[model samples]
Target: MSKDLRESEAASLDNEVLSLLGRHVSVRKFRPDPVSEEQLEAIIQAAQMASTSSNVQAYSVIAVTDPALKSELAALAGNQAYVAECPVFLVWCADLYRLREAAKPHLGGAATYEDSAENFIIATVDTALAAQNAAVAAESLGLGIVYIGGLRNKIAEVAERLGLPELVYPLFGMCLGYPDQSPALRPRLPLPAVLHRDRYDAGETVRQVKAYDATMSEYLRKRTGGAKDTPWSAIMADRLAEPIRLHMKDFLQGKGFLRR
Candidate 1:
């Protein structure tokens, strides 16, 4: 293709992808319709294609479809009803167990680094990337999804219920199904606040964040019909003040992760 034609095609593709990503909204309310097996397979295939560190692909996904199991998980996830109501609940896990098992025969009892902090980081990042890819694929298929971070509220019990072995831990859960409601998109931090040029610019970040606070405040006010107008910074401050998920460090260590 000519240079101009190639550039045109690239821009067109970029526009399509950007449009799909820019409209992202978490759907808490879902329709009664069930997600098909074919759709689920396609989503997982897309997730598997996500980039991984050194191609370790140290992640696993569990799709919970049984009503009873979903109900149990819903309770474990702090009573998030959508966890049970959705057609599919996917538990994304940061897993080193598979890799360890695969290498055991070849190692001849040699020491392994699967328990190192660096490996923990890699597994966590790999799981997140794969899950995001699945999320995007589901959205493209006219399905809606909501991530259930509350799955970590009772991580140990959740892991036990799923029968996860050593070197594996649940990172998060996702509820997937057809949408029953259309919620407004949540506002995000301004691009300038997150994207720095060459070196970190604290002053510019502060200024951009202040501007974003105003944007979020308006969004909250409208969303709640004037019931809330809290700025982004104040909300984040509250989050920091709370001792949220304080058990994570100990829990991860108990799971044989992050030893180093």
Candidate 2:
């Protein structure tokens, strides 16, 4: 975190908010220091405090500390070395299996709600919200984290490895530890481009987007020494243009999450 980047926090809001928000940096490099048991407990306590739908708490987190398991998970998740190296790797799951079973007999020995996409969506949203809360808490405690969305690459294998029953799907993984190096803060879109008034507005979207691209390009140039460079739009376009296996539909289907 350089002086300019640190001060860029003011570009968003007041110094207090900037201090908190600016602490977020996706740490790929980590020191060998292990996160203490007490710190881990506090992080989880913060997660448990997050709001849940109907207070059903349809989510669970699995902390992976076994070296062999972490290595295997790293291989499954695009071979991201950080997964294997981190002291803690947490898998956040959209878990409805326990609740579904408990409600089965009460729902005339069948599912309380029809197995459908809507149910899956609810669980997914709940899990995501809870995981984000945990991530914020970890960062606030001086711990670094990187979300491993790539864990979806081999979703079924991961679920099986974790011994997850049907209706419990791995939503995402978070790698955690003491950061070895602090990466630069990535630029974000200007407020007007994303925030809208009463009705939706794209009037200034194009101009704001172009400006953001310029900001990102400049940031990357200074950070990467022009070795690898890309504008935000270009990166997004390339990713979306390709036939990426967002194989989430099939994964959910296999888990019997949205049978309808």
Q: How high is the CA lDDT of each candidate model?
A: 0.94, 0.86
Error (Å) of candidate 2 at residue 239 is 0.3
Q: Model 2, range 110-183, lDDT digits (tens) per residue?
A: 43653688788888888888887878888877889999998889998999999999889999999999999978
Model 2 whole-model lDDT (C-alpha atoms): 0.86
What value of lDDT does candidate 1 attain over all alpha carbons? Answer: 0.94
Query: Count of backbone clashes for each model?
Result: 0, 0
- TM-score for all models, in order of appearance: 0.95, 0.89
lDDT of 1 at 186: 91
Alpha carbon RMSD to native, model 2: 5.2
- Candidate 1 local lDDT, 118-171, one digit each (tens): 999999999999999999999999999999999999999999999999999999
Q: How big is the positional error of residue 6 in model 1, measured in Å on the Cα after superposition?
A: 8.6
In angstroms, give how far residue 93 of model 2 lies from its true place.
Answer: 0.6
